[model samples]
Target: MKHRLVTATLSSITAAGVAVALAACAPTAPDSAGAASSGPSDATLTVGTTTDVVNYNPLIGNSRTDDWITDLMYPRLMTVSNTGAKEAQLATKWGYTSPTQGYYDIRSDMTWSDGTPLTAEDVAWTLNEVKKDKPAGTFYGQLGDFASAKATSKTHVEITLSEPNSSLIDEIGFWGVVVPEHVFSKAGSVATFANDGKDGGWVGAGPYTLSKVQVGQSYTLDRAKNYPLVKGGEPIAAKVVFRVFPDVNTEILALQSGEIDAIGDALPPSQVAKLKSSSGIKVEEAAGLGYSHMVYNLDNPDLAKLQVRQALSHAVDYDAIRSVVLQGQATNDHSSPIMPVLKSYFDSSLKEYSYDPKLAASLLEQAGYTKGANGKFPLNFKLIYSLQDAVTSQWATIVRDDAAKAGITITLSGTDRNTYLAATNAGKYDIYAGNFAIMDDPVTNFTLAYLPGGAINYTHVDDPTLNALIKKASNTTDEKQKISIMQQANKVVYDNVYDNIMYTQNLFFAHSTKWTGFVPMPSDLLSIVNPVSLASASPVKQ
Candidate 1:
């Protein structure tokens, strides 16, 4: 098996792809899933994107930018394959040695960026560290049931779980980015380490290493000569430069002006016509694994009410936004965190908040809200989002405009990405827009966002019943039992509108003809420029 595993995600959980027409072509085509490039060799890749990595480590860093770079610089036993299933990457093979124990066949040739040999010891240490961090570790919620990882040898590691975790392969592969135990052991604190400035300071075993950071300009990554998977056949690009614009307009302009050879962010649908008209670039509509969600701040007294959250959910029209604003680039996904892609696990019976200003007003009134002299609801709150993102900016406006119809006064607050994340984590707003990449498993996705103390549980839901259901689902090895338990948890989330999910979006990308091998891969939290696909891309023959 290849080192990179196809991450199971909303895009290909089943035969259907990400959206409507996209879903119609069930049993997705192979090329659409991404592959190794057969294009020109020995080229440099320059990509334009909004935002830069705020933190070097993926463990604490939650931005798309951080993930993009870390994916390229880290080693994973497995990765999301094009088919959306667990496929091996660094671990050529893995299997269960017992009911609750497993082993990974770590690649013997893998080495860190600093030339230290990467062994099963690194993998075991990484997993143990992740456990030590508890639910906050990246992808830890998916594997919180694991007991420990012990090195059996230099080329193999054994994993023992506290209980049976059916999603064992999914959990380890998705979050277990191996860190050099030798290096981190002396750091004292992994959380405070800065792997930047000179040489990007971090050690990795992937195809590319962080070479330099030019502040707001770009993050330069140089291809590693001994990338195990690439070996004799290295990535066609010697260097991958990610230029930050912070604004999609600036990113698009850079792409069109030839200042950047590629773009990894979603191109606004309104500009699709203009981008398509250009002869120098080509745009492709590929399935994406991320979506925007409206989260009610539990700390806000007014928004804490179930009725207020439900009213807000009903205040905006999901289908309208998908139709008018998205320009047919999205799907009317039910607010359930589980994508319909997981046909069985998805709670198909759960109803979505249909747009009904009248019903929304009534719900608000029922929840103790009254229209004031100005004919608007007395309660007022702020809707926070990343102002720099084209989609978020437009989405905030759309929701604000529609909310006015129900006499709900929603003050729009758009700020930088870092600031937005900080506010949500601290629960400092009345309402927040959670723009996130979908997780491979629905149970993992749901618990991560809503279960009590779940790392990204911005709402801070404290229901014991809901949390117990999730815990039960997570610890089981039986698929039917897990699905059944999650069904109950899904109901609780819907009944409470834990996170007012907006809609599912297909990742939209446009690249200059100058680059030829990058293709879109399906992932909940990654873009077409996902490291797996990027490694397969190359510069065009000039």
Candidate 2:
């Protein structure tokens, strides 16, 4: 995801209602026996996060914290259900009218927090502006084709595409965030517009509106009067607060001490076991939609050679990392970017690289690199990873030691999250190690991770053959044909060692047992405390 920032502080907005009204508006919750029970209507849910939100503009910023905050204010056309299926959010129904045309029918009852009616015009304008400016975030690539979106009626929208892309609806509908046309149109350029809500007049269409922000500390969101997606036409919580903690350990302590109710980010594998054994806490697990991987920057002359890249891939002990570093909570089977969770698109035929230090040394020697008097190869590449990631910090040492056995010298650099992101974007590292929270769509993921100039193409790869295959896969509408073409592309990536996919681990989320009704989604980023979850959640009656 992309990243940037702006800072501001606003006064908190309080909801006005009596306890009787709150009880009357309470949503029904399932009892232990599956019968209906009354849930809280005026509770405040506090969530702990590792970092502060970088930007308020959903179109420009795409960090995990950004999504958690902006998602509550800005509505998407569709949302992903627990099963990873597309569900209605703002747009009630959607489908392709023809090979090159798609349509969305939005609900008429929904209105912005400012009382302005949210219509098809806003959706069309959002999509069109993204396609026009090509913002440096997630939404632009999801557009896929150069075309236009027209509001056929106040509630209906038609989108024209230059070519048939079967995945566009799922990609764009679920990923795209719509803003108020009237509010955003005044901005000189949407690409640079911070949308920080410095005026305290932010208008939104979802369950809540950003009410208060204490930079490097906390963000407060007040519940909207009405939200159609949840029961009782509103969120159960009167307000939601995201507290920024310095690290995972600190966040965990706060959750245990009741300083916060939930942790927005997934708990690291090392901490999951202990948290599961703790009292008054519930740990939820979900299938991971992404994987940890190492991307070698082709800009480095040594990494540009396929043999050296492959050699480094073989040098790492995958099983050891999965067992020791990940606590055996991860699956280390897949070799390509299309993780095993994506069943239909994952290519199982491609074999994973075996752990063989001898083979690695032989490949380095074959590539004309001889071991120096220090018993190490001439290579001294630096690998950079986020210091905030405990798993990466632990496993990076293993990688460096393992590579040394193969006569390859690797230097490790662990920096803060912001510095790590900036370095990755500027191509400042010889090797980049990180993880993506969600790669829901294979076609879109490939386009963004492997295609030349892709938003997350840290590898700096620009192979013509791989580019052509991705383009071919993107243009087709046939499911079987697309799958076959993508499998071919996966083989190309695997053979070239474009990226070394480490593993996919089951994500675990911890929250207070005092609250319930959190809906778990697929990816770690959205598994718990998503907008839908926050709206559905309620405090357990004492």
Candidate 3:
């Protein structure tokens, strides 16, 4: 049994190979799930994304820019394998003798892209740096319980927490990205450390190493030959070049013309529909674990009334958005805070709001928000959102029209990405729209958003009971107990306590049929992509 456990690497590699081969052949061959078509063997595949990689930092907004780049350049301590098992990436193995403390055995053979050996001290230093305060620094308070991490040996490390944390394993495995202490140690804080035009700050043990990076044009990655092809290692994609475009329309055109092999994250609904008719352009749709939610500022006495909030929730037409904007590609969320993929933990009893303007007006009227001579609600509120996408603008327009019928007048406001997040975080708006991306567990979502003074909690929710429940869940180690606490906490948040959820939309990416092995990883982290048939792509005729 110990031998079976120790050398599970081959079985892991073989399983990945089979998955890649099967995925590559599945589309062209009959009676199989529609994968992309066959291609001539090649090593380099050019990918198009909306954002460019100016910095190879993993702490960035979990953006596709950061996701695609970091997956190639750096590796985390422990990562979810292709088979969805908790396997070691830099750490050879990890075990917990107690809920508060866990020990990890580091791989002695693993080294950074610069050929420096990966030691436990590097992990310790990076973890410490992540906790320091600076602009856009510090993780959610769920990581607050982390007391200390110390190296026991050259190949072993131990982390001790202030309290029992059940989610520690998943949290460490997810957010605990190891960085080279040798390079980053010079910087006193993360804010002062500059990655500007230099690949020195982020040396990691992933499959590909950063070769060249040009701000808006392209970023190049080459295969890490020295990196082991072990269980949790990134697979070989000889050259992964990400081409950044200005907008989604241009990205779609580039994909159709065969200028790029694949494009992701910025694909629009109309473009996806157009791609359906084009021959040899394969399309894949999956339920993104994220949700595009409408947040109500319950801090306002007018908006604080549960019926008024519920009324506003029922005013907007979800079917219209799902039908007209989403083009029948996305599913209507029936109030599942946890994504459909997390079936075991998701709560189903929460009521969904349908388009019933009359019902909404009545609810508002019953709550004593009677209309004055202006035929509008006795109050005027401001709505704020990200101005980057047409979908957000369109959704805002629909909301404006619906709320007008209920005698509530909302002044729609738009801001740039950075400004939008800052405004929301400062609680400067009455209503907001944004998606929570890259969260795998319910703990991060519920705890961070609704807990008092929590970093992401824009709604200003201040329920002591909710706060206590969240703390209890975070400190508990038993899976069943934690899940029960999570369900109860979600019920408190979603069941007329704090906020409103719009609908969860489907994630769409435009790609040519020649590119094979594109599967939707529900986690927004695109680290584990296996572009196996990249070796078979047609050569650039230039």
Candidate 4:
């Protein structure tokens, strides 16, 4: 799910009403049930994933790889709990010294995999470098409100934000994953960071250490011997192999045949049903923080017209696609960009763009788009989607159909994900379809999408008013006030200027019935809780 800014404060715009209306069905609670017993003994877990972990170096790492490494190597001062609260991790306990400043008491038991004592300098160094190079790391943008970080003692670290932010602890909990500053002081760029993953430059203080890696096939990790959290201080399996697959189908086949234990991206509902019926395999369908949407490039001359965009939103049949392609497994979203299960920051008052073909035609006509001599709307466009993601291709087809009815003609273009990304960065598409991984916190979900130049803000929105609202939402430390302002901003984005939002997906992951101890996270994003927290859980006895 994509990260968004916190909805801190608002004037209670009419949009708040729509937010409340949508929250009536907001996804809550995980889907998979607890196993009767724990997972297998230090059995080397053979998990399957589709992509390569971009980087293993914590300071420069900011993807699924970070979540995987976070569990095995380094520890955070605090971590987002199942309930979305900042709970103890490396830090035993913490509290605020003032409204905008706080201190964390490190746990005496924490240590690096190398047996080095985990101290406050490591925390200070990690965060200081993040502040210096804010754009380098994915989550560093949140640190713009940070003032200074100081080590009061060997075990105590203090953080002072430039302004009040209620979600400061949540952000800090993620940002607190410390890195060995001593290692990366020599590496200077993103390329060097990529090279670090294979050369063992991607070091962490977690329970597993990088053992060996093959560029595309697999990477091996060994149980950290000095891990302070586990009972035995290491994994039962001496070596864990993370095998890579070319696509979801190949990974699913491996899982069915017992060649792999788990897969990352959830299987579609049809495939999930098959897994449920299988003897040893079990399907876990969790309320995912994942959201997929249609993106309209504002740079397109025709799409820049608000009337044309509205007509397209009105004509598109999201419900039909949700039923046919998604098998009713997804939910319709029309709010503060698709948010996760933490809490509904959805503004209830904004009007939902309902499907009305007649209205769509009228809006298109009003936008000065007329059918050309070829018996189609003069608008010639391309729907760019990833050829690799099957579900996105389905959405593109539905969109293509809806636009045709409105007298608009579209050309379909599908390319491999990496090539598509390269084209997208170079401003290549007229419209695209994709999903954003929602973070556990509201700010991380809302602002990250609408904020100018955010990681996923491919639309290139630069509205001064929206930017100002985002600034206030991030700068203010208070929760209630921040939420209000965020709601107001959400209204502007949803009603007047949003590109397109079709549906937010509910994730469904297929795992083995015998595997226990995996606490399902709301977001599709994965963590190493099994290795760290569930390592001691014993499997159910048949």
Off by over 4 Å in 4: 1-42, 62-71, 81-83, 135-137, 189-192, 195-202, 229-233, 335-344, 424-426, 527-542
Which candidate leads in lDDT? 2
Backbone clashes in model 3: 6
Query: Which one is best on TM-score?
Result: 2
Q: What is the lDDT of residue 408 in candidate 2?
A: 93
Tell me the lDDT of candidate 3: 0.62
TM-scores for the candidates: 0.89, 0.92, 0.81, 0.84
Please tell me which model should have the higher TM-score, number 2 or number 4.
2
lDDT of 2 by residue, 164-276 (tens): 67667667887899999998898877787889887666899988899999989999999988787665677888899999988888999999999999998788889999999
lDDT by residue (tens digit), candidate 4, 15-123: 3222100001111112233422322355666677666666565555544544564456666665444435454557655555555665666766656655577788777
lDDT per prediction?
Answer: 0.72, 0.81, 0.62, 0.62
Q: Which stretches of candidate 1 lie over 4 Å from their true place?
A: 1-42, 81-83, 133-137, 140-143, 197-200
- In candidate 3 the C-alpha lDDT for residue 335 amounts to 52
Rank list by TM-score: 2, 1, 4, 3
**Over the stretch 1-542, how does candidate 3's per-residue lDDT look in tens digits?**
00112212111223223210000001111113333333223457778766655345554433446656765555676544222335445665665546566666776776777788878888776666766633252243446677777898987777777886656655565556676788777666654565543544346666566678777798777766555532223333468788887656676778778887777554567677678778867766554666677777888888788888878888788888777877775655565566555565776776666778888888888987777888877767789976655467677888888888877787899775556666876788988877665445676566668787665677777888889988888876556777889888888777673656666666655567665455444433442142222222333233
What value does the lDDT take at residue 451 in candidate 3? 81
- After superposing candidate 2 on the true structure, give the runs of residues whose Cα lies further than 4 Å from its correct spot: 1-40, 81-84
